[model samples]
Target: MSTSTIVPRAKATGHHILRIRGYSHTKAVVATGEHVVSCGFRVNGRTWRIKCYPNGSTMEHADWISVALIVEPEAAAAAPVNPWFSFSILDVDGKPVPEHTSTSYGIRGFTQPGCNYGWAFHRFVRRFDLESSAHLMNDGFAIRCDIKLMRAPSLRLEETFLDVPEPDLHAHLGLLLDTGEGADVEFKVGGETFAEHRCILAARSPVFKAELSSSTAGTCVKIDDMDATAFRALLRFIYTEALPETTVPAVARQLLAVADRYQVARLRSVCEDKLSGNLDKMTTERNANSPPVRAQPRGHHGTHRWFIIIFWFMELCLKFLNLLGLRRQPPRCSLHHSMMSTSVDKPHDDEARPLISVSTIVVSQRTGHHVLRIEGYARTKMMLANGQYVCSGEFQVGGHTWHLRYYPNGHRPETASYISMHVLSTSIGATEDAVHGKVKLSLPGPGGELVPLCTYHNNHGRCTFTKQDNAISFDRYVARDELEKSSYLKDDCFSVRCDLTVFVKEVRAVSLVEVPPPVLPHHLCQLLSSQERSDVFFKVGRKTFAAHRCVLAARSSVFKAELLGPMREHEASCIRIDDMDADVFRALLHFIYTDEMPTMTSEEATTMAQHLLVAADRYDMERLKLASEDKLCRHLDTTTAATTLALAEQHQCPQLKEAVFAFLCSSTANLRAVVATDGYEHLTSSCPSISKELVAKLAAAL
Candidate 1:
């Protein structure tokens, strides 16, 4: 007989399974009381087989046919095989026959030849049954065995799983806010007091830690410059790590100050984030109506170096006027110095019938009060003789830029002695309708007093500052005879003071999209945080919520009329709302500011939406009403269905009404309740048509 050697396959791990085909063929040669072996199959790169005895393999079981599986030439030099296997004798269709025996169990080291182990199969099948069974079809069969070895456990340095436990720190801290159970300290702010834990405050704030530990901390700490509401919000944040939107912006500045003073880093960070992220930023641009009369041009004159030069030039002019033994520099109104843009005193002229009348300068720079006083009047006097106009620094007055043109000697053909001054609107191409201002020009007298020289006042329609016409003039403004007098021109440096009052109506391009400012961190949210800082208060039953009047008026027409109308009710800046819950009002305020409905379950959201819907409808806030209506429509249940239907009927919310009808009709339980509730009666009176639909839906449900 020729033998075939089994070779190892590539890189497989664990035990190998082998099945012998036609395993029953050896039955013919298996004697009734003799040892029998079948052709082997390759297993783990080695041949293995079933060792059987037609009778018993051992004398003790001679009456039974025993079965055993063994390695043919036992793997003496190979790695140990720890295996579990099962064997089945297959029938004609390659299926295990019921009558045939199957063997399976653990085996020890099977290295040497004949070193075999297997399940003891005594009386596995009766001799008669084996001979008669299909397992021996044509005296031949197949045996299949499934064998698996536990994969070798390898030592590894890398982690196979990454799940680290984290402490639920904030949750525990949040519990401390309501229960000052271990609080050892109290604070007094305004007339109110608040309680807090000493350890927590000390841990969160270094200032608090030091102050509380000091000898003087035994007494109740009085917090000055901070209100009770703001202090309460601060304390809440300290304990809970969350800043409640109770009092803000109005309280924000105070709270920020307190946080800073306490050295509470996180509290400061929260305040900064709330203030910066959600706070309103006041714009620096001035109002456009009555522009700044003394408002100087922004670009050219803002430099300190140029201001210094202007200052020195005015000082020299004053010195020259003093030396000439003539009238001193004009009253220090504008040109002598830069008036603190807010000062608006009229130029003080000595004479009753003054030549120049100076009134309030334009308040904002956007106005047309562009005036420039050029010194060295004597130096420019030659320009008058040469028939050339002397110039003043360009200034912005009203809505247009202007510069003065002075013909020192005269504008006349003959050698005349008249001084001519003209104001030119620099923006000649501007399409502005008209710009008007009261122009006053005067000379400074001795002792810094103004000598009125020239004045012109007109309604906004006077000298136009539009594209077509741009200049206003006083030709032959003053005779050279009058100006050269000591009182008028002193030290060859007569100072001119021009006062102007202006009005400008600027037309801006109309935009179709009415883009309201971004409503966050909401100004109303800040206002809500501003408790005592608020001017308006809401008494929802007994609970009070302080708010700003501007915010209320801006949000609701009903509130505007109630708070600011001719027949107002806010005598004490308080509105009493008896029907709505305080919690619901709080939710309403939040919605007004953030436009975000409160987080609630479907049922709670629906219930609250009904009340909010009614409040919104009563307040004439269509947006809030629609928001509440939408929320109710989305979460309609039996509890809110009738009330929403009533609100929808009252507010004409067709979608919400339809949603409630559909929700009620979907279940008998809701319909039964809707019929029993008074809201349905109100709905019927308010909208009989909806009642008819509900009646039909109810009838159909029955």
Candidate 2:
């Protein structure tokens, strides 16, 4: 086994590099060309460097710099790993000419003066790999030793070659050009050949590069001398397109303009960045000042721009918001116009443009769905593209369009203007609100179900804002006009005015909605108060606790075991438990129903709520149990509280007791105070541990 070692050469300490005390005269060869030169390098911590001519082409006489090498300790411990090394040769002008190489170098783990050591020389050969072809041009050679002899794995040997191509000045300058269509050109690479096409095409396009005379054309800008390298850089942009970095801002802006005109998106992006950073003020300039406009970049698809790219991002945002049920639909206008003066002397002209307006309707239902209605508008009162007419028929909400058709009887429709002039002028929330109007329909009171607003409708044109609660009202003027405008509106917007200014404290169920004739269970009002019913439940399993009136029809032996009660009667008897959350057991007592358990702890209430849910569920009182479980679940941390409650609620005997203990032990203040304030007060004696905290919190709240 060939042993491997590292030899430290030198350490570059800022300026005066401290050379490794030993191995200063080690020999190295040019890895690129067959030019032999003196070794000038140092390896301090296995780092090695070879100094060479500034030109990097020929190293006939070169001063060596330092390079560092590092070898992994694991690799060193295993055995000597193969250490690949490289060096550089240079020409007299520091340009690469030809290269040389070494077959292999051996390293020993010697500790003293010289550790890394090994060498062999041979004629250099070009690798010409794709990566190399893209970045480097072969001209010379050099050699390096495996610094791994010092046991460093991360050893690197870099050959400093001379005569690297200088940045093309013309290419740098070409980045500033623009097309008449409001686009700019941007530079991607430093070479002249990369951007040639962009330069040539820009000059050739009718939208750019205007011609000028040699004499009186001093005032007119002309392309007198285009740099070949800049043109080449533009060509590169044309072929292997790319964006510009903001380093050369002016050039990048110009190049982007060129790219935009030629539909080179990649180049356009680079220019865009440069413009945003450097010439941002010009972003809003007119298209006539730049290049032919193309579609914006994919990044800007929903973005906004005046000429270059008009991104519909706002519309897209509105769409997303609509989907998420976020924003109210914006006031939509199909006809928008702007008047401009020609040097302040031109007459004002109404530049009306036809467009589409969509209205959104939010419906109250279990499922969240939106209706979009599109309406067309134009001052000309004529259908433009599609058969979109502003007729006198009632506008109905469609999938994504507002369908407006004229009534069968030919009549001049004034509803659209009236909607603009009057309907939109009022705010629905304020006295003058118009966006929304309400019509009061009297409903059932606590004792009686049906009531009518006959008096109120008769007394005032409409009900007071408070009396109309949540009902929709139309603009009386608009309603009347819409009715008159539409032979259809008489049927569509049909309504009979009613007035009931009586001081009725409560609403009754019968007046709520037209109900089918039936002797309902506790009146049809219960179904209407689903929200209230939901809030009254205790949750057990997927459903709510059985209703109080509901009786559990227990099936035999197995059911008794499931109920977990010593006395078969408690299991068998239909228990009329409170319609509260079972988690309430955690804070309050299920047995005490009259007074609110104010002193109960959140933990106790949670336990009580859960037990109540189990009792409600077992007894078939769904509403109470569901409400209890939901409240408990929402208030408590699911992990700690849910696990305990779930187990307690699962079993019967200790289910109530254990759930109560865990909840009482889990001291969350909010749950404690809620039980107190909601009139469940007797919990103070039951849950002594949290009585003080609950009292303080409830007192503070009050």
Candidate 3:
């Protein structure tokens, strides 16, 4: 025999991170009381300061170093802003200083002094520790401050009314190169003539600026030594940070060399990042019958200027293939139409280009369903791919890509009890304020009654996805026994519906095109409701409320026992209720119908709130009773306080009685008027247990 275990997940509210650049000092050497501060980087238009004190802020804590991140005092005092701030030091290699420590939450909205958070580490880095550390070099240091704004940021993106022309810098530069428009210089190389803009070249490259300044040649100049093909690639990079997506691998290294020679840091980093990724995957990227980019073993540098020149010519030949528009056509290389045919020695006319990596392959879905079926429960490998515990294949919604990851045997502390799932989004080049998403996981139930097992589908329950932490997961999802039931999993198959909404800076409407409308936006309660289609009826005296048995049963166990249980009423279509007035029962029916109590004021609740509270107690409706009591407490005054106090004493609602005692004895409560009410006579006669608490409150107020 085998036993199964399920894990529940808990939700971590917010996650945040920030990357700071341009640290001035490399080695920070400070005496006691001296501190170093960082320059500001803008996020949501707020300037932040990271102050690191080598000595403590106070003389008493002199043995410790203090670190703090402060908001501009002027900005913070204008209005209270709720933000979560975190600070960290950077090592010499530009990584956050790894201090496995808890963060200080600054959620209490900032006032006059402004919002700040930090630690005065009594056992912070010792003087000797900094003196011998590799990270603390040249007196230069960097720190990052990240804020998780618990409150939503403004997402106002005003669309333009005018037909504004786009700033197409690349297209304009390409045009200049092609048509020689405003061309100030000309070059001749490898039997070809090219016209170029001297100003653009001068601004982009110091080498070009220096050469043009020293040149005596007026409109035309002869060039040698530099490969013409390399020069074309270099010119393109000057205008665009990246090459075309189809740029062949053979050309990447040559492009890097040209970028290095021109001292173009942006282009150099792009090339290096691409090369590094490809180099890492060389061994595992291909197998037999699939020709791949072979990796040369790590060793001394090969003196190979000829290979760079040859590959540059090879990439130039690809331009002709692009002109033919033969993209994605399985490579049938042809040296016959080569632009730089003489640059490299070719034994034959064909050499296959590398296949595009699978990482670029994506599935685009404006609207669709992601179905997950867990089978062979004991045999299937539960571990998720890429180090995740559980994950689904990529899916798209609302113009964003997402992947769902779940943990069945919960991660870490949550193991053996809950199920956890998270949705991760692809990083885009925008500073979005927030991304709110609602998802529902369901189990296939009889007659379209999908048992919603896991959900975070409400305004309060919105899972915010941020660029800092692209995902959110539940650590305590649900109890183990619930999922193991036969009704929850019909032969081990569970499904989920993922819905997402994202707000970006340049907000363009994402056309959903031919997708069907999703039902999740309305929630299941909408369908189960509707007076026209209810299956069961609750009759109270002369009034009746139409209801669905499934919904009532799903929300309340009491209703489930009466309607779906083995009781005689389970077979009956109508249930007659008495001892409750029509208006009071109707209000109670609304709570049963929606599982959400109505909002009430003390005067408004007076009509049926007291009777409804009694009915709620009889039917074991705790939420409705609490809601009623809360509204009554808010309305507590001399006229109503005595009545409420009597009701609380009868029902044994300690909280309500405590609220009444505190209110009636205080200056705002008017205790003399409360004592004159009709219920006060019964309160003193039937409820003598409140005398002590009442006397204590009266004494404190006096």
Candidate 4:
């Protein structure tokens, strides 16, 4: 089976600060319905402005302050613009007042004559409240507008699952071996006879193939050297490509010898790994009781002839030292320069060389992230002096406890004008050893998604944390002036995310077999195309489809209930399905058979996905439903947005509904285009509450 993936759209973000000097004078001079507009600033290659009405933009809100964000007409006319924005009133310290901050929930569209698309908060703040608050400092205040613009969505490569069955060739072969239904040969060992197929044995071993090809069909071969139990294990490995878990180390040794004689390389390797592990365990125990051995420094080497002379001299010295009770244990030398030598003493017999086996070591890392939101940023800066820090609650990552240390006034006096951040490991016994990892720090975007800051100070490569250095520090994390002027410091708060990846090492036995890829899906697809042994038939529209009842039952609970449960039709030969197109039904059958989507053009796939989503939901196929939802999300356009929104609402798909809403609300042009389509009328009639929800979302965004 095959799979497909959907990529998310890219976004460009920027912010503008509007400082109104002499606020009191503007309130008195500007009349209601009139606004004082700031110079246009560009974001995503489009110009935008902030409009503030000291006496409110309309008569109804004359006693309240009004603020709005507008897209420039020239830029809007070039193409539809979708942007998400927020407005916050800044205090004397240049920090946003929490109660005066407003954010958009989703994207808003801007088109030609962008006046109608501008978003405004009619009653942003009461005139009396602004006049009395400290924010109205020196007869003036500032407003920060943060905007995030949405670009066209594009596809990215990702791994997605297909509903293909797992490979089972070994299972089938093992079953054949156990049943012995087509046995044409026999092997006698220790007066015990075993029946087996000649072809099966010949294919697994060249020795068996040579012997079997020269014998008759019903020949009985007698094994004199090998035991019956070891022979049985060899046959099992040949058929299953694996040994039984019940195979003991003693039995494994015997099997290893037999496998080697028959050239069963995989079986021999498995036995060797098992025996090596047992030997390592025994050696560890023996060494634990003996005196500790100190490792020698590297890069020391001598000629082979000189090495032999030194080796004997050292041996004699060690023996003399032992005799004098000056040493409790004899020294074992490791010759690394010219040859690979073990610490164990060498035996006199050349044939008794120690067995060596190598284990595979896999080095990897486990990564996780945590976000620390610093509320009341201004207050924290004032309260914490240089060298003082506030720590976030402990969060676990890579099986270790960690926390973020935030120094509002900086960790050192030299960096007092900037913020300091550090990630400290707090695991018990952490000081005893070093934990190696890479660290990255970032801030959350407008949508609450972490955006990596990639600066030299924020992203530190390969840090080793030990008792000497238990934390990784970003001394100049962010300049206070830069952060105070940025959109991130909203509601007097901002968040910092720490992503840590700790390295881990693992050792395991090497595997000899290179397993083949799965073919169950291919076989199932062939069966579906052939319509072999079909137990059920469906009549959809004017076309008929043949399918296996068992396959359908296994994939969908609804199909199971309809075909095998108490609700099943009695002796019904051909069940009729209505309100579905024949092509959709055929596509559905293909997915059910092979767990893959059929190839189709982009436009056709988009349309088919909608219908298939409905069919999938009806049959309670969640994966298919999700796949369809993802397809519709990626293909959302002006023409299909309204219809897809209505479908999402009707089908109880929250994610799809949200995607449609985000697409439609991104720009006023999108809303207008969608409303001009016939689907908009159907949406309003079928899902009347959606209009209210859309308005509510827009209000929340403002």
Candidate 5:
């Protein structure tokens, strides 16, 4: 019944602020439907911008000033990005003017490309209110846009003690035997008949198969000299591959005989093992109770009875051995003579004893942690009433779905004076099966570092979560007065990070070989650096580089065609590469040799990846091109998204194209910022069809 659960952790978030000077003049010039754009800023590794309409974005709300936050155009074409944001007007002291601030109703999702509008304050502040408010100081004011970007949940692997259920083939077969719905043969043993499937009996015993093949379906086979109970037990074993737990020594002996008669080797062996175990028990008891005798007792009836039992056991053992081809014939001596001879003969001292082998199973535990931060603390308290809680976006850890539940004013009235926080598992059937983990709650320090609040530890115990009781809570997480007076609360916001460690157990068998990591790349890199026996040279932009022709040919098809084909430049001592920088060519050669990209600064890496991608495409180096595309995707910003999209389109990289479009379409502000870039003009001119596609994607999203 055990199953795997994917628990998600809380999403990480980021924020930005935009300041506008000379607000009055800017407003006078930028009428309704017109806006002022802020410089592009980075948040959560993506580009974003803020647009402020002096009046309003549209004529409908011309009396009020409007503000909007946008993501990059390329971001719009991918999966939706939901970010929680708040717009606040800051006074000269840089404190928020509470009355003029607008926290988002909830998370806003930017899901379409070329979308210029996102979460905006359409009637943010009336012109009259702005003119009278002291927050607008000296014809200038600053706007803080606190944004919490919701990142996708990441997967974490954990080793747990929970065992997945094994297959139940025997149970299914047992059920079939009990139902007798498909029974084709009937066995009549001692006037008691048992109905069973001919195929099942045939599959279990070769003698039954031979006997049944000779008879027609619906035929009843008669058995002699066998108890009906033993026959029934035999039929059960044939289907289930196991004897009933309550089987006694008497029944075992009878079953063993019948099993041997029908050629059911495994059943015969099982019955033999059971009977032998009973024999050992009886012999041990008899030895403990009786006095030792030096000679055999010929007249005693008890001795005769024990001798007969031993002889019968030996005879069955001989038959089983003969069936298994281990013995060709049975011994000729009578049981009485054999027992008498064994009693007089000395016991063999060279008999081998059983051997025991010992090995250890290695059990290891893997633990991982996820941090959840709650922003707009003050606002959340005001918005949510008692007993109401807000949940952080779902995150994944150890392949399980989880979320943080924050009760600003406590979860119940009993603890209303305190803030309550709980970590809840959203995994299916979590209540039925418990997940074990620990939690540590903390507040942000002045340096944006974590300051310990309180930890809920089981202290050698597990904090178990199940579907019915899916949460581990700190009801008195923090006193409202203590938090308000503490330095942790600032800017009407506070963050709490939950360090969660899920415990999973893994068992691994000992391995003979301790394999080391591969070093081929390191060796190849050394070879490239040594450059010994180099046969080819390339000149690019006043710099020349040396390389091995075979290595280049092996890594690049274009190089193979140029170096080994009939049109090879045999006379030329060095090849001249055009339209490429010397450094870019050097990097390309390095990749060809080592299959690894050299490290560089973030800015330099982005620029180099673009150049290397083009070179990779030209040389038909798919891996290198894909690596470059992945790098570009991570570094995509408003300024470069349009150009990157054009590059993806031209290079026939569907993945990169999709990523760029997703970024661009994520928010209207993103699209506007990208459009304003010089790259956007180039994109429109070089790939006009892309603009139409963007429009179509946006239309569909709407």
Candidate 6:
């Protein structure tokens, strides 16, 4: 569809015309607040399409006085030859009035010259702030004017959720305001006092201190004698250190008043920096919803609470500033340095700010979006949005360990908690009680270190413990068996063999030593024993581990020929295995017993990579070698890859070396990723035999 054309006729050469395109008016009482202006009119006309502010000059022209016209649909062709039109004036109630009514239109008088025609309302004197009493005409027709104007206009804000009216009791601890003269006004539970040296007090318990005194009082600003605008700003500062994202210096300067009044120099310093650092931020941003500045407030004492409120406000501001990456590295105020001893002053500048004092903070475990509401003692409220709450603090809840920390923005994150279990049993064959023992329960960290998790002392009930080969065992050590079973043997015994070794702690393994058939009759043996309950245990080396009640055994269903049987039938053959974690070993044990593998962990997967390389050489398990190589290729790191590459080279695993070299070559551009794939020796040495072109590409990239 074609666009429609709409244009206006241009004015002819040098012609002067005054036209009001639209008229809007409001009737308001005169400044006297008594007499109202009725029939207030404005004319509507246009010379060109552009509009300008209204005044008397444009309305008084006689040439266009009656020349204005409004086209009716019936007379659509052209402008009317006779354009003059007039309409009656009406009051606010729309009541029509006589022409000679009391309403006045002219500046001094309503009529024209003594013997002349009537003078129009537009012929009045110069501009005035007051509304004019005029009969406004447009296209020779009268128009109405009754628009309303507000006394004041502004952007409004809602009350913050954290708004509080009184100071918090907890904030009373170590709360002292500097009083100059190397002293502070301190308030304790008993009463208020002035002192230079403050001491710590244990009002709570042995580990926790109830009270702590500052080396020096907090920063200060004088607010009592300041104007309301300054006083109000000071209050805001106490709650939010940095002013709003856009705060004027004039407003920030008031923070000095708050700081001085509350004696919080830190807040005062923050205000000074905010005002000084970005002079143009506030003006350009135009944040009109800022805290209101009281025009006039009675007395300074009643405003005493403003200082503390200002303190928290400043705190919130600092948090916001830090979040926005605008936090300043404030220089030590000269006065503070002068007061401190020579030794203390320098450290103060170099030392990191305390965690609580730092507005920009990181917590562990917390993540995503969250809003924090902090209500200070002074009853001031501050709101922070989009902060991550991480719980770095560690604690034990319900026998589970949890760590708390924060994300960068202050959201909480998921926590990892672990529990410990101890008693285990191994079952072999159809025998009910095969092997029983006490074992420590824990998960190994990345370094293959066992972290003491939880301790579960199992007595009876059957559970399985697995080791090398197809060996399986079970524990039937029931708690009730302690009272019913009796034997001549002083110590109980069970037996099983395991090659794996682990770091040992307080928990002991069950002793599982085999026993010969009893010589005494069964009925007589039971009667001769002093105690009824007897415990069976597993034995490893000289140490004995116990199985309390029932002995549980772990057993595997299938057996296969030893892959390395031809090469080494001797059990004494020794081989070194490095970089393997306990979890992988555990998986191997589980596989031997149940023909099933344990669920893998990331660290275990790494260990599995190492195990694969070792097995490739010792047993020549081609499938295992290929599987380990594939895992290594997928998760190759510099350290592990280096070791794997070396082992592959030593074992003459050409395919493994080729895979490692390709990975190394492909990642050369990523220095860190490549270095992390640690097989530098392979890349420099064995890699050449694999691919010369890849080596060259890697060298060029590197």
**Which candidate wins on TM-score?**
4
lDDT tens digits, residues 1-702, model 1?
111222221111122222333435544555555665544444444445555676666666665566666654433436555556555665666556555645454544554434344444655555566566666654444444444434332311110111112322333444545644334577888898676655456555667768887877874788777778878877776655666767565676577678788766556555554543231121012123322333223344225323433443454565576577654344433332333223233344432231111122223324333334445676777544636786655454553456787787776656357777777665445335666666777776556566667876556434445556666767667787877765655545565666666655443321111223332223335546645236667889778888755445545667767776787775776778888898899988886555567665445676787788788887886777777776665455555566677777777877566556556655566678767877777767777787678778667644
List where candidate 5 sits over 4 angstroms from the true fold.
1-509, 569-573
Q: Rate the local accuracy (lDDT) of all candidates.
A: 0.56, 0.30, 0.53, 0.70, 0.68, 0.31
- Shift of residue 577 alpha carbon in model 1, Å: 2.3
- On residues 1-702, what C-alpha lDDT tens digit does candidate 6 reach at each position? 001111111111111122222233311211211111111011111111111122432433321111111222112222212222222233333333354122222222212222112223332222231124343333111222211111121221111011112312112111211211223223321232333211111111111111222334342322234555554343333322333445666676666665665555555555655543342232223223422222222236224224324443554464576578764553242221122333321323444332111111121121121111111211210132223222221222211122222222222112111111112121122122223323322323334344433232256522233332221211111121331242211122211111111111232211111222321122212211211222233233343332211101111111112211244222422222344444443343333222222345444676676674564345333444555565665455556656666666667766566555544543434335655453654555665553454456467534
Runs of candidate 2 with Cα error greater than 4 angstroms are 1-64, 75-107, 110-143, 146-236, 239-258, 279-702
User: Model 3 residue 629 lDDT?
Assistant: 74
> Which window of 10 residues has the lowest lDDT sum in candidate 3?
1-10
Which 10 consecutive positions of candidate 4 have the poorest summed lDDT?
Answer: 1-10
Candidate 4 total steric clashes: 9
lDDT per residue for candidate 5 within 465-518, as digits (tens), equals 776787888889999999889887765667678777666545433221222333
Clashes of each: 27, 211, 22, 9, 45, 126
> What is the per-residue lDDT of model 2 for residues 35-112, given as tens digits with 9 covering 90 to 100?
222222323322232232221222532332323232322222444434445433333343333333222344323222
Quote the RMSD, in angstroms, for model 3: 30.6
Where does candidate 5 have its weakest 10-residue lDDT segment? Answer: 1-10
Model 1 ranges off by over 4 Å: 1-519, 664-689, 695-702
**Candidate number with the higher TM-score (1 or 6):** 1
Residue 448's lDDT in candidate 5: 56
lDDT per residue for candidate 3 within 1-702, as digits (tens), equals: 010111100111221232222223312445556665443323333434455666655566565556655555443336545666555655765556767232554564444463344333344444455445665555444444445545544432111011112323344345445555435678886567778756456556677767776747477878675677766777766644346675555666777777778777666655655554453244133332344333332222222223323443555566666677754442333331222334243333345433221222222324444555454343333543222364554555554556777667665553546666666774322324456656666555533456665666456755666767877665555554566675554545544555454432332222111222322212223433445335578788898877755445534557767766777275667888877787787677666544554544325666466776687687766676776676676556677777788788888676677667666644433678877777787788887766666887777644
What are the models' TM-scores? 0.26, 0.18, 0.32, 0.38, 0.37, 0.19
Best model number under lDDT? 4
* Model 4 score (lDDT): 0.70
